[model samples]
Target: MPHAVKTFRPALGAGSVLLLVVAYLVVALNARFWGVVFDTTGLAGLHGAKVVAAVAAALFALTLLMLLPLSLRWTFRPGLAVVLLLSAAAAFFIGDYGAVIDRHALASVYATDAREAGEWLSLRMLAFIAAFGALPAALLWWVRIDWRSAPRELWSRLKLSALAFALLAVAAGVAGKDVASLLRNRMELRHIANPFALLAANLSYLDHARDADRPFVRIGTDARRGDVLVPSKRPVVLVLAIGESLRAASLDLNGYTRDTDVDLHPLPIVNFGRVDSCGTNTATSLPCMFSDLGRAAYDDAEAKHRENLVDVIQRAGYEVLWIDNNTGSKGLAARAKELSAAEGADPSRCNADGCHDEVLVDRLKTLLPTIRRDTVIVVHLLGSHGPAYHARYPAGFAVFQPECRTNELQTCSDAQLRNTYDNSVLYTTHVLAEIVSLLGEPSALVNRMPIEALRCRARRGHAGAGACPEPDVSPTAAVDPGIDAAMLFVSDHGESLGENGLYLHGAPYAIAPDEQTHVPMLLWASDRFAARRRLDLDCVRRGADRPLSHDHFFHSVLALADVRTAARKPALDLFAGCAPSR
Candidate 1:
C-alpha cells in the first residue's frame, strides 16, 4: 500500500518472499538457539564446520528465493513486516520457558486438583496473538497508506544488486561467526569484534539447541589448561545456592527494596555487588562459570574445551558430591557427584524420578560419617525456577500467597509473579541456612571446625534464563571474626527481567544490559581463617575488587579441602595476595 499497492501488488510474489524469509530466519533462529544450548553442553560444531556451512547454504538459498518475491512486489512491506514480527516472536519464545511448557501437564502432576491444559496454552497463545500476530497485522493496516515517492530510480539500482544483497544478509551471519572466532582473538580484536562476535554466539547457540540429546562434555578427574588445587585445614562444605531465573537487581544485596530473601537478611555475609556473568542460559552460564577460562575466555567452543571446579576439586583429593535441584544445564551440577537419576544405587536417598536439592544434603549426612579427610559438596537448588514457581517449594513453604497461577509470566500480574518468585527466595534462604547448620555439625569434620557462609552473585556475564529479583539484598558489610571462616557466595551471572524489551539472558553480548552482566558477591569468614592468617574481614570486604572470577573457585576449594594439587596456584587464593592498606 505504501508503494503502488493495487497496481503493483503481486499476491504470489508477496507470499513467496514472506515464506522464504520465514524459512531462512528459522534456520537463523535454530542456529542462535544452538549457540545458547551447546555453549553450555559442549555439543556444538561436532559434525564439523562443513555441516554448519551446509546450513548456511540452505538459509541463503531460501533468502534468495525471498528476494524473487520481493523484487516482483517491490513494496518491501511484506518482507519488512515478516522481519519485525518474527524477530519479536523469536525473542518472546526463546526468553520465556513458561511459554513452551505444557501447563495442564504441570497441574496434572496432582490430578485431584488438575486444571485444564488449554488454560496454560491459552496464556502463551493469547500473548502471541496480541503481540506478534495482532499488533503486526494492525501495523499492516496503517501500511496501506500511500506515502511519498520513496521508491525512485533507487529501486532500479536495487534490482541489479538485489540478489547479492539478499544472499549477503545470510552470508554475513556465517562469516561474522567464523572469521571473528578464528582471527579476532589472535589480533586482540575480540573485544572490538563488533557484529561478528555476536553472530558467532548466535550460530553456536542454534547449533547447540539442535543437538540437545548429545552428551555435553565428558566429566572426569584430570588436569587441563589453567587448572589449580591446594591444601587446607578444614573440610569444605559448599552450599551453592543457585538462584533460578534470577536478576541481580531484584536482590536486596543489589539495592532492591523487597524482602525476597527471608532468611538471608539475618546472616553476616560478604556482598560482591559488582560481579557479572559471561552467558545468559543455564547451559552456558553454569558450565562457563565452572570453567577455567574466567570471563575473558568463556566462549561456546572453549567452554567445552575446559575443566571446571568439579574436576579441579576432584584432583585435590576431596570427595566430590553434586546435589542438584535445577536442570543439569547450569554448569554447577555437571562439576560433581552423580546425576539425580543415578541415585537409584541408594534407595534410602531418592526413590522417585529425581531428588530435591535438600536430598543432596541428606545424602551428605549419610556420606560424611565415613569421610576420614576433607570433602567438597555442591548443592544446586531449583530456586525460583519458573512457570512452575508453585513447584519450586513444598506445601509448607508457601508463606507468600496469591502466587502466580501459571508459568506464563505474561498472563499473571507483575505483583502475582513477584510474590510467586519471592517465595522461592524464601526457600533459598531456608536451604542455605539448613546447609550451613549441617556443615557446622560435628559429623561434618573430624576437628569439627566451624563453617563460614557468604552470599554472592557474579559481577556480570551472559544472560539466559530470566533472572530472579532479590530486591532487598544488602551490600557487603564488615566481616566478623566471631563468624565462621571462608563464607563465599556470588551469583553465576546477573539477569535482565524486562529492561528495554529485554526479558531474559542470552541476548547478543554487545546489546546485553548491565543487569545481565553486573552481579552481587558477598562473603563471611570464620575465626580460624581470620585469626590464623591475621585476616582483616572488614577491610577486605570493603575494598573487595581483585577480579575474583570462578577460575579461583576451583583453586579455592582445593585450598579449603587442604589437598595439594600440581595445578594449584597460590595467587588464585583470595587471601594469598592481600597486603597492608595497599
Candidate 2:
C-alpha cells in the first residue's frame, strides 16, 4: 500500500487557462493574419523583430483586456467559449472569401435569405465549421478550470491587466515610429486582427442598422417629366440592366484580349471604358446609383427614404417595373411593380441553385406588350456573381474550359477561377444581344422616315432629317410616332479575381482596389430614339474613353427617361451634351 502512493498536481488557474486560450487563438487560429504580415512586411532582420514585438504587445494588450471581463468565475467559461467560437468562424470566412469581414460584408450576410445563403453552403463549409467552431467549442466545454473567489480573482486580474498595459505602452514607445508607419502603409492589417475584426464589424453593423431604421428622409418630391417630351407618343421603352460583380477589365468591349463581349460587337453599344462604381458591393451600389443624390452626397438613410430612378420615372407618367434575377434590388425596387425569378414563377430559367440572367429577359418579353405608356423596365441580373461563377450561366455557355465548378474558389486554381468568371461574362454578352434583338433593329426605325424629310430637317439645323420634324413644331410635337427603345447596362460593382491575394467583393469603398471599383457600362439606343432626340452616336463613342463614375448614373438615367426634376444635374449626365434640347 505504501509503495502504491500517488502524487496529484493542482489544475491550471483561471488566468493560466485564459493565457493558453489567447495564445492558441493568436498563433493557431490566426494563421491568415500572420501570413499576411509576413508577406506584406518584407522584413527579415531587426526591423522585423520590432514588428514582431509590436504585434505581440498588441495581442497581449487585447488578451489582458478580454481576460479582465472573464475574471468573475460566473463569466469565465461562457466568455471563453464565445471568444473561441467567434475566432473560429472568423478564420473560416477569411479563408473562404480571401477577404476580411467588414461591416458591409456583415450586412450582406445578414440580408441574405436562407435560400440565397444555401448557395454558399457545401461540404467544405460544413467541414470548416466543424473544425473551426465546433471542435474548439467542444474543447472549451470539456475543460475544467481552477478559480479563486471573485474579489481575489478580480484583484489578480487587475494587476495582470496593468502589467499587460505597461508592457504594451513600453513596446509602443520603443517601436512607435516604425509601428505607426507599418500600420499606415498596410491598412489591411487592422482587419486581419481575428475576433476583434469580427466583433468590431458586428458592432458597426448594429449601429448602422439602428441608425437606418429611423424614418427615411424623402428626396425627389418634385419629380416630373420634362414638357419638351410628348406624353401621347408611342411608348419609349427604356431597359436599364443592373449587373452584379462585372469587372470592366474582363469585357472585350473594353479591349480585354478575351472574347467575353463578342456578341455585343455588332450592336451600336457605347461601352464606357473608364467607369468607377459607387461602392464595391451590390447592397451599397444598387441603392446609391438609383438615388438622386450622387455618390459624393449620398446618404444611405436619405437614399432609402427617397424616390429613386424608378420612382421618378413613374412620377413622370411612365410605367416602371423591376424584374430581378439577383437578390431583390436592395430596396431600390420596393415601390415599383417587382417580379422575382426565384419565386418559382418561371421554372425554366431557374432551379434550386438559382436563376440565370436570361430569366429576366424572358420575363420582359411577356410584359412588353402590356406596357402601353412610356415605360422604364429595370432588369437586375446576377451577372458574374461569385464564388459560384460557373452556376451563373448555362452549362452550354461554359465556353471557357476547365472552369471552377465549386463555390469554394480557393479550392480551384487561379486560371480555373478566371475562366469560370469569364464564362459568366460570355453569357452576359449573349443576354445583352438577346435583349437588343427583342428591342427590334435600330435600322428599322431609320427606314420608316422619308429621305427628303430627314434631309430637310438636317438642312434646317435638326440633327437627323427623317426623325426630327419642321423647326416650327414644338420639341414635344417632334416625338417619333414609332416606338423608341433604349437599353443601358451597368454593373452594381466589380469583382476581384485573385488579384493581390484578394477575392470576391465588399471591401470598404474608400480603400477598395480598382479591381473592385471599376465596372462596365454600355448603352444602346434605337435609331428613332437617337435621331428624334438628336443624340450623336459618334459623340457618345468618343466620350466612352473619358473618365466617368457612378455619379453619372442618376442623371443619365433621368435624362434617358426624360424626367425633369431639380435633382437632375446636367453636368453629371453623360448624354447631356449629346442630346439636343429645345
Candidate 3:
C-alpha cells in the first residue's frame, strides 16, 4: 500500500483562467493585427522572423494589459469581460471592411443613425460576438475565484505587476529596433494595434466630444441677401442635391468607361470633372460645405452655432426645405423645414438597411406643386454609400453582373466589388435623371474655372494682374427675372472602393487620398431658368475641366438664391463670372 505516493496537482483558479483567456486573445484571436503588421512591415518575406516578433510583441503587450485587471482583484473578471467585448467588435469591423478603427472612424460610429448602424448587423457579427464576447463573458461570470484576504491580494497584485513590467521591458528591448522601424514607416499600423487601437481611439473621441460641448460661436451674423432681387412670377426653385460617397472617377461623365452615368449622358448636364470635397466624411463635410467659412478656416464648434446657407436663405424670405434620404442634416438644416425619407419610404424602396435616394424623389413629386414661394430645397441623398453597396439599389438596376452581395466586401473578388459599386452608381444616375425629368427643364452648369482663377481673382485689382472685371451690376438688379428652376448635384465626399486597400470614406481630410476627395459636381437647369439668369450652358461646359471645391458651395448657393449678403464671396461663386445681372 505504501509502494507509490500519488502526486496531486491543483486545478486552475479563476485568476489563472483570466490570464489564459488574455493570452489566447493576444495570440490566437489577433490575426488581423498580425496580418497588418506583416503586410505593412514588408516582413512577409522573412516569415520565421515575422512570426517570432509578432508572438513576442503580442505577449509583451498582453502582459502589460493584464496588469490592470490583476491589480484590481475584485473587478478582474468584469474588466476582462468588457475588454473581450470591445475586442470582438473591433475585430468584426477590421475584418469586414479592412478598416482601421481610428478616431475619425470612432466618431463615425458614434454619429451613425440607428438605421445606418443596422446595415452592419449580420450572422457573421453575431457569431463573432458569441465566440469572442459572450462565451468569455459567461466564463468570467461563472468561474470561482480563490478569494484570498485583502492584504494577500494586494501583495499578489504588486508581485504580478512587477513581473509583467519586467517581462515587457525585456521583450521591448529585444525587438525595439524592428518594432520602431515598422511603426515609423507604416503610420497606419497605429490603427491596427488591437485593443490598444480601440482604447486610444475612444480616448481621442472623448476629448473631441468635450471640445464640441463648449459654447458654439455664431458666424455670418452679418448675413443678408444681396440688395439685387430676383423677381420671378413662378417663384425660383433651386434644388441642391448633396450626394453621399459618390466618386467622380466612377461616373461616365467624369471619364469612367463604365455606364454608371449612362442615363445622365443625354441630358444637357455639366459634370464638373475635378471638384474637391470639404472633408472625406459626411459629419465633417456636410456642415463645412454650408458654413460661410471655407474648409481652410472652418471650425465645427463655431459652425454649429451659426446661420448656414439655409438660415440666410430663410432670413431673406426664401422658403427653405431639407429633404433627407441619408442621415439627418448634420444640423445644417436647423432653420429649414426638414423632411426624412424614412417618414414616407415605401416597402420597395426601403427596408431595415435604409431608404433608397428615390424615396426623396417620390416625396418631392407630391410636395412640388404646393410650394408657392421663392424656395431652396436641399435634397440629401444616400448615394453609393458602402459597405452594403449591393443593398443600395433595386435588383433591376444592377447592370453589373456577379455583384458582391455581402457587407463584408473583402469576401468578394475585385471584379465583384467593383461591379457591385458600379451598380450603386448606376442607380444614382437614374435618381439624378429622374429628378431632372421631373423638373421638366434641366440646365447644366459646369465649373471650368482654373485653380489660378482663385489665386488671381484677389489680385485682379492689383497692378499687372490680368484685368478680371468685377460685376458692374447694381445691388438692386434682378439676376433671374423670370420663372427659374434648377437642380445642382454635388457629392458630400467621394468613396474609396478598395483603392490602396481602403474600402470606405471618413479618412481625415488632410491626408486623404484623391479617391476620397475628388467628387462630382453636376448642374441641371431649366431652359427658362438658364435664359432668365443669362447662364451660357456651353461656356459653363467649357469650364467643366477646371478645378473647384466645396469652397464655392456657400457663395454659389447664396448667389443662386439671389441673396445679396456680405457673406457671399462673388469670387468663389461658380456662376459669378458667367451671369452677372448688369
Collision pairs in model 2 = 454-465, 454-466
Model 1, 1-582: lDDT tens per residue?
377645443233333444444553444434433343234322256543533453344445444444444444455666556544545454445545311111111111222112212223445655764675457545553433333243643464355356546655565564546533433332312211212232344454555435445455533344432222223444434444455456667666667655455345555556655556655445556666666566566664545545667776666465666655455534444546655523443444332223334565565566655554445555555555444565556544555556776656666666666666666555555565555444442122111212111212211121221343443434433322222334455555554444543443444444457766665555554555455445566766665665555556545544444445455567665545442211
- Stretches of candidate 3 exceeding 4 Å from the true structure: 1-22, 41-71, 155-181, 211-213, 227-229, 296-302, 442-483, 508-512
- Candidate 1 residue runs with Cα over 4 Å from true position: 1-123, 126-202, 205-241, 329-336, 341-357, 399-401, 441-487, 524-539, 545-552, 558-572, 577-582
Clashes of each: 89, 2, 12
| Candidate that scores best on lDDT | 2
Per-candidate TM-score against the hidden true structure: 0.56, 0.88, 0.82
For model 2, what is the C-alpha lDDT against the true structure?
A: 0.76
Instruction: State each model's CA lDDT, in order.
Output: 0.47, 0.76, 0.73
Better of 1 and 3 by lDDT: 3
lDDT of 3 by residue, 1-582 (tens): 578875553445544665676676666556766776656534555654754564455454554564365436666777777878878887777666566767767767877988789777778888987888789778767666676778876676666567667766665676656676766666665676667778787887666556556665554566554444466568778899999999989886766765577567557888789899998888888888988889999765567766788887787778888999888898788767898877956888886688887898888777777767778888998999888999898876665667899887767898888888888987787788777766664321111223233223323232355655543333232233333678889998988888777778876565578989999999988877777677777877887788899999888887766677677887788876677632
**TM-score ranking from best candidate downward:** 2, 3, 1
Candidate 2 on 1-582: residue-level lDDT in tens? 468765554467788777777777777777777777777645579888777778777866775675577656787778877777777777876766767767878867877776668878778878876887678767666666777787877777878788788878877888877767777777776776786677778887776666555665555668787755555556788889889899999886676766677557557788899999998888778888988777888766567667777777777788888888887878887877888855655666766678888887777667776667888888888898887898898876766667899888879998899889988987787788778767765322222334333234322221232344533322222334356788999998999998977898987777789989999999999887776566788988888888999989988888777777777888888987777533
